[model samples]
Target chain A: MNPTACILVIGNEILSGRTQDVNVQYIARRLTELGITLAEVRVIPDQRAVIVGTVCDVRARFDHIFTTGGIGPTHDDITAPCIAEAFGVPWSVHPDSFRLLEAHFPPGEFNAARQRMATLPEGATPIANPVSVAPGFSIGNVHVMAGVPRIMQAMFEELAPTLRHGTPVTSRSWYALGLYEGALAEGLADIQDRHPSVDIGSYPFRRPDGRRGVALVSKGLDAAAVCHAADRVRELIERLGFTPAEGEPP
Target chain B: MNPTACILVIGNEILSGRTQDVNVQYIARRLTELGITLAEVRVIPDQRAVIVGTVCDVRARFDHIFTTGGIGPTHDDITAPCIAEAFGVPWSVHPDSFRLLEAHFPPGEFNAARQRMATLPEGATPIANPVSVAPGFSIGNVHVMAGVPRIMQAMFEELAPTLRHGTPVTSRSWYALGLYEGALAEGLADIQDRHPSVDIGSYPFRRPDGRRGVALVSKGLDAAAVCHAADRVRELIERLGFTPAEGEPP
Candidate 1:
């Protein structure tokens, strides 16, 4: 079985529609490349109880748990302390992190709020931020990262090599213009039934220019089965008198 | 208090990073305008058990639940059936929907797969789809809409009037181009503490041109409180020797 992961996006900005999230897609693509099945993703607020409860629940269910947002030098950045409470540990400053942050800031500028970035749950290891000096941290299965896209990507790059891998999931797709899903759903179901291990999806798209098409995608850990299913999908499209093209619809 | 809501985005395409979702932001903005608190958003796969369980769990917790995706004319579109199971009701054809869909398609073109689009839980009201002929539905507190953005927006627009609402949450923001979050975190916390009702958020952003800034946003149902918080944020930015610009940083 493939290793599974869940992402917890903790922020009020995203929930309020003030920010459009690009981090989930970036991490999802990376997890797919690393052969980890991203089973679920939840965009939640920065409420302390919500963060703590969700962290505890998802950590026990998935092989890996990634949390983004709420780790910053502000009052709403309470994810670290909440996470510590969830793990039944104390929230405090790590010596190396404190030293690194203190040295980075000039004079007495590194006050309590700035020092909050150096604080982590007991036994947490820092995930280096190449974009910023302050770091994210890993406690048990949960890896906490920044809300900013570049910083989150940097933290994930630093953390990816340590995760458990599964067989890489590959996909094959064929899209045919003028082909509607209703015309191909039955035959597609037959192909899916034949390839029990492969996951087949039929998506219909209507372009802005008024062109319509259906893209049939087959995905699985077994590349052969995935390709075989795609071949059948292409044949089905041809049988319906529509020309099948590679990749997604334009 | 504003009526709480949750958005359940059901799809494998999103989890696999094959598609970037714009529906959540659109719906979140709409919900904010309608005075409904969008507390959570979950993206799960197109699996039966997961859908059924999530629908049951969320429907009880929030005043409203909106689900997007998997309401198509394909084999993977099992949301209708799963929702029926969640409510412990029979999944069958709604006569009006069946007649409308049958008339929309030409003779013999409306196959069994297409007929599935007319199926819904026993007690459900069809939400009219202006973009496409096929309709989405609402059962109890859960409103099921199409995954496609235009269709989903149409459904939401048709259904929006019927939903219960509270005082719409308003927001005010001020961003400073040269301001770093660390320098203002203390005073920002003080401002946040003073405005007990207003929710304040500090977001740091780096533009592609390498220009970095921090945006302080205040949100609340009380318009005066939100404005008052924003004034303090702007004052804090000025005190820290940075120019505070209205709205978010460019």
Candidate 2:
């Protein structure tokens, strides 16, 4: 089994519908490529108690935990302190991180609040922020990164090389055209049962022209098993008299 | 305080990053317009125990709950039974729903799997699914809808009128170009402190060309208070020597 992971998105803007999150997709794709199974994702508010509780809960369950948002310089940037509290570590300033931002900013520009970015959990290493000077941090299995898509992507790039890999999961998908899920359900279930290790999923999509299609995806640690499941899915689609397309249906 | 809701996205495809979810944004926008506050969102895999646990947990905490995905015909579609188990109610086929799908599908098409769409929790009301014949359902405060964006939207439209409303939250935002989050952090904190009722958030953006900007958003049940906070954000931007642009910065 691949190492399991969970993502915690710490932003009220996301839950409030003020901002649509791009971080989850970015992290999910990155972790998948790194051979980690991205399991659960929770979009919660920037509340301290909630953050503290959730971090502790998911840390025990998943092999790796990623948290995005609330790591900025604003008053709403409460993630760092909460995370420190969760680990029972002192929230302190790292001199190296402080000097990095200190030298980058003008003498008078690095105010107390700006310096807040330099403050992280005790013993946590600062993850480099290439987009801006304010760095993210990592402690134990939890990797706390920025919320901005660009910044988060940068932080992930910096952190990716350090992570341990598991057996990489491979996936194959068939775009099932002219297929009703009802007609395909039983056969698909039989295929899933036969390939016990492969995780199969059917997603229905509606086209702009009012046509419907389903994307049948098969994923597993074994590439050949996943491919075999995909073959079965294609055959089932053919038996139902529908053409199975690869990638996305046009 | 506004009537709060939680969205439970029950899809392994989303967790696996196989698909980008458009449902959360759609539901968030709709809830905002209806004067309901979307408090939380959880994107979990299609696991029965996890679904039941999350549903029960959120149901006790929030005023309303909306779940999307896994309500299809396949064996992987377990949302209905899990939802029923969450409420300690029997999962059985509803006569009206069965008749609806029974009539909609051709003679041989309404297989046992197709009929599963008609299965729902005891004492639940069927929400109309105009896009597809398989209807979504509501049991108490939890509204279960399809994973497809189009179908979810249709079901939400059908269910929106039935929900209770709270005071609608109003938000206003200003884009600050050539500004730093560090420069705006203290002033934004001050503004947020002064207008305790409003929620102020500063978000940084990096353009395609790397022209950076920050968006200051203020939200509150009181429209005037939100606008006042937004004005303060604009003034802070001007004081920091950047132009405050309305809407998204060009």
Q: Ten-residue segment with the worst summed lDDT in candidate 1 chain A?
A: A201-210
Q: What is the per-residue lDDT of model 1 for residues A214-249, given as tens digits with 9 covering 90 to 100?
A: 888899999999988889988999999989999987
Residue-by-residue lDDT tens digits, candidate 2, B89-204: 99999999999999998888889999999999999999999988799999999999999888899999999999998888788889976787888788889988999988888888
Candidate 2 structure quality by residue, lDDT tens digits, A8-116: 9999888777678888887888788889988889888888998999999999999899999999899999999999999999999999999999999988989999899
Per-candidate Cα lDDT values, in order, are: 0.93, 0.89
Q: Which regions in candidate 1 have their CA more than 4 angstroms from the true location? A: none
Question: Which pairs in model 2 have colliding backbones?
Answer: none
Clash pairs, model 1 backbone: none
Q: List candidate 2 stretches off by more than 4 Å.
A: A208-210, B208-210, B248-250
Worst 10-residue stretch by lDDT in candidate 2 chain A? A13-22
Q: lDDT (0-100) at residue B108 of candidate 1?
A: 95
TM-score of 2: 0.96
Candidate 2 - CAPRI tier?
medium
